[model samples]
Target: MDEENQQAGPSAAAAGPAGRPAKSELVDNQNFEGQFKFGRLVVILSALAFTLFVSFLDQTSVSTALPAIATDLNAFETISWIGTSFLIANTSFQLINGRLSDIFGRRTCLIICMVLLAVGDLMCGFAKFVVPVTVLAGIAVFLVIPQSPTSQGRMRDKVKMIDYPGMFLSLAGVIFLLIPISGGGTTYDWSSPLVISFLVIGAILIIAFIVVQARFARHPTMPFRLFERNSAKILFAHNFISGVVYYTDLYYLPLYYQVILDKSPLTSGVLILPLILGFSLASAAGGFAIARLGRCLPVIRTGYVLWTAGAGGRIAFGPGTSIATIAGCLVVEGVGLGLSMQPVMIALLSNTRKEDRAVVTGLRNFLRTVGGAVGLGIAAAIINNVLLQHLPAGLPRAAASQLSVLLDTLPVEQRGEVVAVYMRGLHCVFDGRAAGDGA
Candidate 1:
């Protein structure tokens, strides 16, 4: 452990009433006045939501533009890297940013992240490269999110507060784990020594990271006590599933349009509009529902039900599915995501003490990012592996690898065969989520 580990745990004086928090902590509605006025809070959430939308839009837009990008760069095999790399960088520093936000304040973190995002976009525009752009975008999102009011503090030694060892271990663990999962069969064989080494090392580091959190960490990046309640466990699982479904859909739907339907990148993006609108509307509705009901579970349940239904519906799609049908399916999912997403955060706050809000929020977001990254990896692996195994007998490996980009150029029967294989992979992605939902 580093010298920083000595300063990891929160002081006992600040812990207050050991073990789980009391019901008094749950009296959020009664003592809510000191936070923000309902109207002002609404406005703040709206601003923060818009900020999130813009940042996320920047991320999703890359997927829509991917076919064109792969063609232009002649890097179709490495296209998955564009998204995975972003997710890796984004997820790696999540807890660090969460702690930093608690210390420096959300506004300061947002400004820094947004500025970095702008700089990253500018770099992409000039250089026409995606890796650095994704990295910058990842860094930009680290602080733009709204933390609970309790996270703001009067602490002066914020820099010293970071758990450097935990950060490194978690980052290494996630990267090592994700690289092989995402790259196996596509970049390297599953049985390759490189893959086995990464998997083994990643698992060990992850266990070490958990050990640090459980015992060694002074102020653990993710406190074990956060999962003490059944509600917290459920919410974390819910958030993780939502992350998987959300990212998988976001990344793959564009492919469905571009690859199966043979639409242009810009056209695919335009088509994704309905899903976004549904998401925005549903999100707003969730906020209103929670505000009126003074509880988040009902809305969350409704969202999950809708989300499950939407994922199930998407499995019905194929090469001949109508645009209207696909759009409708996306709308269903959008509504579900909107209704369920923010309520989880609200539920976490309702369940935890004010002091732990920042960490809880960080953990929630961290899981979601991890879910998204893992989902993308799984989706990529399925798509690549399936294509490798099932692409038409006559097509060369190189052509089949770039089949998504070159689908339209092939003869009609060849394109059909390729689309059939691609759709199988796409359907598998959705089906897995549907199964997860059912479980």
Candidate 2:
């Protein structure tokens, strides 16, 4: 009997007294590492990494291209929508995408997303106007993301599990909210009935979304239980603030270079290299440090401190700021961003249960993208309002609205004055950024 029991081995031994598998044994059974050979594991990881790279590239590439796009299309006032629309879609579909991947296989969802992205890019190249092109691109990003298979139930059952009320409410709320934010004081007056109506409707829809998620949904897209923990709340807030700062800088910095510093679009892109390189290097370094130290809080704290200082430093940027000063400030901000990014995600994952990890991850990304969309809208409103007030009064409405492309057209003497006004607007933006970072 003893020899026969020994022959049964560890798998049988992993059962509890009730003859149920141990929790750890169940987890081990689900481990992808145990199923794949070393070479196969490498290929899987590489493919996933490449997918992530493509998504990130699409997001960041717009920053440098914005100025040129505005100039080419003569749509300076509406250009923010290009980025905002992408983020809005990202924020809206983020959670649903996870649920969708559960219903359809991961491979199927990925193929669809990639097809949309490719088609969207192709249309953008041939696009003659701004708004339509923006819409196309926005629609395209259904979000090129990957999800793991969760083959739990029948297709019909899986489809029924989706939070339809949560999906429509959130999507509608985001669109209504963003329309006013992006257009108020530019396309429409702040006090316009159109703006006020959208704002009120959006708030109501968002509140309704929360209520549905909390009280009604069978499988809530955003589980309220996650926010019950204080740590999760803090991490969510941190990610939101970081996204605001990151996208604000990404979008505005290139405009500053091209408009105030008189640099070409290509040159502006090149100048931002310090920030990008520093971020990449610091992210890698932070990962290694966390692995070595076996903790994340220290790195996170240091990152916030550096980021705050860097944001404050950005306040000094103007027409006369040196390239060296700009580079140094950007480096500091980039390092801070890189250090802060992964650690927070790691902390959130550490705090969450394994089963809830997917939802928590989706929520994190959703909040960040929401922050970015809101930040861009706020920045656009500030700059456009200031420009409306300070731009040369005699300029035509068309020219004034298209000032992003009017630098060359303005008289030599007026160029300096226009640049000065732009700097003032940027100052307000940076001030708000510094305060947000400090908070």
Candidate 3:
């Protein structure tokens, strides 16, 4: 193994209590942090925060916009793809981007990502069609976000070190798995040969990917050794579940407001502010609390309690539900998410060897994003299947397929039934989310 790979390899056999890495095995990179002056560090953090904000906005800004996009393009059935496609691309390339940053320089990669995002955003603004814009944005952001600086390596060595087979397997696996889930009920029947074929192939490839990581890759993108500690396993599980809940809420809540509540897109966006503000404030507070308490479990547990309550509250949503009640539930859910998100990272870093920090961090992100993609797929399937089964018989199949457009054009007398059916689908989604949180 190369020198970098040796350092990044599995921890020594000797273990601390609970199979955790020994303190002596943990390399402290305090000097790296010390390299930055206080003011410089502040500037760097601010810039990074802004980058994250932009990236998140790019991910979520489409939520409130989906209703409008569906109506405008008359493609309500495919609207979910705008978000799912981006996440698919994002999740597939996430770990590879981290490795790339190590090979090239951070600054070089960051600049390229920013430029791609800017270009994608600009093109999206002008595009008349939906698919093209989504494709462009997905490709642009695939390698655009997340990473840290590291020493530049020789081109030949870096190229050889890239886990090409692992990358291909992971990328193809995600694509195959998601395509069927997203399209099964909406675009094709669940038992269709194409969907079945893709699912079987995807599963096989995923198993192969795991085998390659465990037995073949010299510098595995996700080192199995990190899961040695029980804490690490729990933390990763929390991260994945939270991602599912977070993205599901972000994507579906606006649909609830606009479609069921008869709110405009702008009004729905405005209403979602409570969730955003509550999450942001709680995240900040949680970070400080962790620093002060020097513990993460308490906060994580508290957050889960709140999250369950909030998610449970969502199942009560109805045509008669008040705006205040909706907003309150959202705030509680957001705060729960905020409280748990950061501390999980801190907990993971505390347990990990410093050499493996970067890889683990990337893996954390990869799993969360993968969860988001899968969650969205499952959500879409549930909603679409429900709509297919429950949509009013009087409505044409063509019209039923594009409910957003139908709502816009349907007479006042016919709209209520359609809206009620849509509400049922949303209720199912919320119920599943609640069950997930409680579990």
After superposition, candidate 2 runs with Cα above 4 Å error: 1-30, 74-77, 139-142, 146-149, 395-401
**Residue 80 Cα positional deviation in candidate 1, in Å, after optimal superposition:** 1.9
Q: Which stretches of candidate 1 lie over 4 Å from their true place?
A: 1-46, 149-156, 398-401
Which consecutive 10 residues in model 1 have the weakest lDDT in total? 21-30
**lDDT digits (tens) for residues 1-439 of candidate 3:** 5785566444434245665444323222223746899999999888877877888777777777876777777667676566666676677777666656655556677788888888888877776667667766765564655553243335665576667888888879978987787667667788999999999999999999999989998666666889999989998998888888787888788778877887887888888888888888888999989889888989888878888898999999999999999999989988987888877888988888765666677778887877777687678778777776887777644322245555867888778877887888888889999999989
True-structure RMSD, every candidate: 6.4, 5.5, 5.6
The numbered model that scores best in TM-score is: 3
lDDT of 2 by residue, 81-128 (tens): 666666665677776676555445566777788877777777777787
Task: Give the deviation of candidate 1 from the true structure as CA RMSD.
Answer: 6.4
Rank by TM-score, highest first. Answer: 3, 2, 1
| Worst 10 contiguous positions by lDDT, candidate 2 | 22-31
